[model samples]
Target: MDRVVLSFGDSLLRSSDVSLLDPPRWLNDNVIGFAFEFLAASLSPPLSERVAFLSPEVSQFTKCCRDEAAAFLEPLALPCKDLILLPVNDNSGPEAGGSHWSLLAYVRRPPGFLHYDSAPGTNAHHARLMARNLSALLEGDGGFREERAPAQHNGYDCGMYVVCVAEALCEQHLRGCDDLILQSITPQYVTRKRAEWKDVIGELSRKSAVAPQP
Candidate 1:
């Protein structure tokens, strides 16, 4: 993972990063952040303008003071963004790492935050911290809830579930649908994503390689 194999904007994936997408290996910040970059880049203009995606690092920073969090989010135009996809990490207190992953989705239509945790209650605290800091800035949408989501069978797949759920939500919203349908994203589906993500990385890497650089 020392040598960079893919660099899309700020998301960088090293040569062996693709292996992290496979089972029994926990997907790190690189894979999740890159996946988000790919997904966000696929949205149409209007929908794109209304949606936002934050990396786990930035999302965790929301647990800080409101002013700081708001300042960090200012450029994203949070007020106008209806759907904010925040990947949450259950970091050990005052530590630099976390053992669990989840997602906190801020929706303007309902004016509230909804958390999707594949491990159920593991990430609830972190998700609420984000909601507490971001709700007012997100149009006084302080109401929060733990929404039902596709559960992962193994501990290492939580990050994958986060990526899948984010994709599902964005796709549904793009299609003018509100109901979430995650039944089809089974463990097998999650496992298959490794190949799909690798394919996307390969395509993007090729495009970047051919593009003229200054």
Candidate 2:
């Protein structure tokens, strides 16, 4: 069956431009380059036809300004056979307390669940808490089933954990089967990583096909 892959994420999921302020640092080139390459290879034919991406602009997806996002998505009558990728971009901008790092918006890094140092008790902190709470809810749901997708672990970094949890929350909300693929974004956020993600997604797709659909 065909599916829609609604990737509502941050700049990492979007096409990024290199920062001129930081010359000799080819961040965008490498990051976006790898992401696209990976996406291209992963979504070839059977899978590509099964999915369509629905990512909106910045203000629509930010932590403080996600009312529009909520409204927009609330009415999106998407097919049951779809995937959701929420790459928290909590580390983006000077407000989020990370001036140097740009995040994939909803994508998160599970490092002991720390809040943004600059904005204590802010909306971003609350949003992270909400996501964490939602993850726990999905993990304990009696009606929903769980499938352990490939874990993208590198050393002690638990970045992939955030993605995996988000996918679980989304699946529960959508009342869909728990079949997802998780991947981490390099600091630069390139397109080639999409190809890498696609490889992982391909594995999940095959597995999901055999699993009972929710």
Candidate 3:
């Protein structure tokens, strides 16, 4: 997940004018809340204006109480013109194994929320729960939709899918397209991105080592 975020940030810098000077470099499954928060913070103007990201902590809090959750999210909602990416994790306990990652994207053109799950149907209930809370918080008429996104072939790649989907959506938004459907993200793409990330991280490490310490 850490490598993926760094790779995505580098991609953004290369493809566009977005500047991510100190992007998040390390994110593990246990600290996904921080991962989402870091993603939200890393976004720069124009792209940042097109999309907003809610932290996993907000999603977790919504599972407890919708009212309180609405209050909590009310202030964090960004004035995004296009979409809001909300990461959701539905796991009860440590004994229950690893948590699953999914996305709840609220798009503005058609004015509806779409849930993208790599494990399709696994997080439907959680998506609906979040939709309700977001509706109340945003004060929009409830119009939630579910689209089975490109599924992950492995257990650990859900976070990768989330980042990839967000990247695709941002690209689409930049092109002024409302068809928010994710086309496809193949294993080859993931493999290439992993290699690219390794190179990016290696360069960053070398640069840090050469810099004089104050």
TM-score of every model versus the real structure: 0.91, 0.31, 0.69
Off by over 4 Å in 1: 92-96, 178-180, 210-214
Which candidate number would show the highest TM-score if scored against the true structure? 1
Full candidate order by TM-score, most accurate first: 1, 3, 2
Q: Write candidate 2's Cα lDDT for 6-67 as tens digits.
A: 12122222122222113233232223333333342445565443332223122214343433
lDDT of each: 0.82, 0.31, 0.59
Across residues 1-214, which tens digit of lDDT does each residue of candidate 1 receive?
A: 1566777877877766777866688888778888888788888887788888887667777875567888777888988887889988888443336888899998888678999999899989888988998875767795999998999998799999999999888877656766645776788999898778878888888877733322
lDDT of 2 at 154: 31
Winner of 2 and 3 under lDDT:
3
- lDDT value, residue 128 of candidate 1: 91
- Provide the clashing-pair count of each candidate structure: 0, 30, 0
lDDT of 1: 0.82
| Superior by TM-score: candidate 2 or candidate 3 | 3
Between candidates 1 and 2, the TM-score winner: 1
Worst 10 residues of 1 by lDDT: 205-214
lDDT, candidate 3, equals 0.59
